[model samples]
Target chain A: MMHQQFQDCIDACNACADACDNCAAACLQEGHASEMARCIALNMDCAQVCRLSAALMARGSQFAAALCRVCADICRACAEECGKHSMDHCQRCAEACRRCADACARMAAA
Target chain B: MMHQQFQDCIDACNACADACDNCAAACLQEGHASEMARCIALNMDCAQVCRLSAALMARGSQFAAALCRVCADICRACAEECGKHSMDHCQRCAEACRRCADACARMAAA
Candidate 1:
């Protein structure tokens, strides 16, 4: 079982991963796929890292703190990129990424 | 777009994640959920790292190789654990994990 302190971060990471996955799929459906390339790419990266960080924390891995640090950085970057877009999916993804980033930062600090 | 060299590994990662998710969900539905706790936990961890490794490779990140090394280790462990179970979901998940581990190993060596 994961430590109680990491539960919120884990939840945030899972939520962000889901949001990012949805955002990437939505971006692919948009008319201007080329325009959303970076967003899609970042979404994929962010989603992966969020999931990995969450799992590491759940397992109580020694590298969880370091992984969370990197996860937070990627989440921040993804959020910034998503914030630039006007699509509803992107907006939602940005919000999720911000929340995950904050949670990951706290986890890293702990 | 990801480099052609990493495409197979990315596909394997995605497939493995799907399999792991299915396996975990199926494990929960079984009569002995407590008995499958380790399997479920490993599935979650394996799924997360596989996604992360795939994204890192897709982005051509400098850390992709190193990450893949760890991912391969986790995938191997997950596969071994899943293989010990008799359920169809576990069998399929074990296969996927093995494939992912192989792909990750190749990626890491590259």
Candidate 2:
């Protein structure tokens, strides 16, 4: 079994990924999906990182620290773009992003 | 505009999300979909958290620090589970996880 700390990070990543997908789907159905392109792109990117980060943590890779750093940066950007939207999904996504970003930062430090 | 650091985090989260979704889709198509249940579930969870974390960071939420901490933990766990599978996609996902996890950790520390 992996260390508890590592496991915790995985959980957070998973949650963040789900939130992003839902937010993206919601955005796609909105009237301004075209305007939300940046948000959509960021959301897609954030989701990808969350998944990758989780996998790396699983194997206890030596490069996980570096990866965490990159993932953290992306999450912040995605949040900013999503925050621009006035929809409930965007607002909820923004909240999730902040939480995930904080979690990733902690893991990197560890 | 958000500080460069925040923007970077968002970018990383979005990338990770895409990787996870792709990996999950590939996993679903594999013959051992039943065996990959845990990975799929973790993938889904990681994706959600990444989205939420990004959104939170976008708004400069005060709770972002805590959220990042959580996101990091989940990423680690999902990585571990995904690593269990011997498929190429799992391996790829594992690598992506490492990258995203490191990125997130950095954001948390910031």
Candidate 3:
């Protein structure tokens, strides 16, 4: 049985990963591919870290706390980068990142 | 410009994700769900971290080195665990995890 905070954080991480994956694919489809390069890159990074954080928590690993701290940092950074873009996918990704970051922060604190 | 090592690590991570995802799903389909609980859980965790590690490398994050170290550790652990199962998916996942762990270790070293 997982703790409530961990469960919530895991859910957020999964959601954020999906959003980031979608955003990266969408960014690739944009006409200005070069311009969206950073957004695309960060989306990939955020998506990966969220998955890592979720998995760590699920297993109740000793490293989960430390890892979640870094994950939160990455999520926030991704959100900031995504927020600069006007694309719908970027917008959605930013929101997911923000939520995941918050959840990770709470989990890390616990 | 990304280095060859990072690129290779990213590729391994992506491959590992696909393998782990398949392994987890297959584990669920096994008649003995309870017997495969640990395998299923580890597969899920391994898949997520592999995604995260790949993304970090793609973005050239400052934290990528440290994250990859932990990622390598998880991949190896997952590989060891997956190696215990006789199923084809588990065998495939173990191979992917082993490759990913080696790639991640090299990345972390560099």
Pick by lDDT: which candidate is best?
Answer: 1
Off by over 4 Å in 1: A1-51, A58-110
- The TM-score obtained for chain B by all candidates, in the order given, is 0.95, 0.86, 0.94
What C-alpha root-mean-square deviation, in Å, does candidate 1 show against the real structure?
5.5
lDDT of 2 at B32: 78
Please write out the lDDT profile of model 1 over residues B8-109, one tens digit for every residue: 998999899899999999999988989999898888777777777777888787567767777788789889999999999999999999999999899989
| Chain A TM-score, structure 2 | 0.91
**Clashing pairs counted in every model:** 0, 118, 1
- What DockQ values do the models have? 0.23, 0.04, 0.29
Q: Evaluate residue A80 in candidate 1 and report its C-alpha lDDT on the 0 to 100 scale.
A: 95
Model 2 lDDT per residue over B1-110, tens place: 23335666665665565456556766776677898888888887776776677666654566766787777787788788888877877776777676667778888887
lDDT of 3 by residue, B1-110 (tens): 75555888999999999999998888898788788887777777777777877766786876688788887887888899899989898999999999999998988898
What CAPRI grade goes to candidate 2? incorrect
Highest TM-score scorer: 3
Give stretches of model 2 more than 4 Å off: B1-110
Q: Tell me the deviation in Å of residue B108 in model 2.
A: 38
State the displacement of the C-alpha of residue A79, model 3, in Å, after optimal TM-score superposition.
Answer: 9.0
Classified by CAPRI criteria, candidate 1 counts as incorrect
TM-scores of chain A across the candidates, in order, are 0.96, 0.91, 0.94
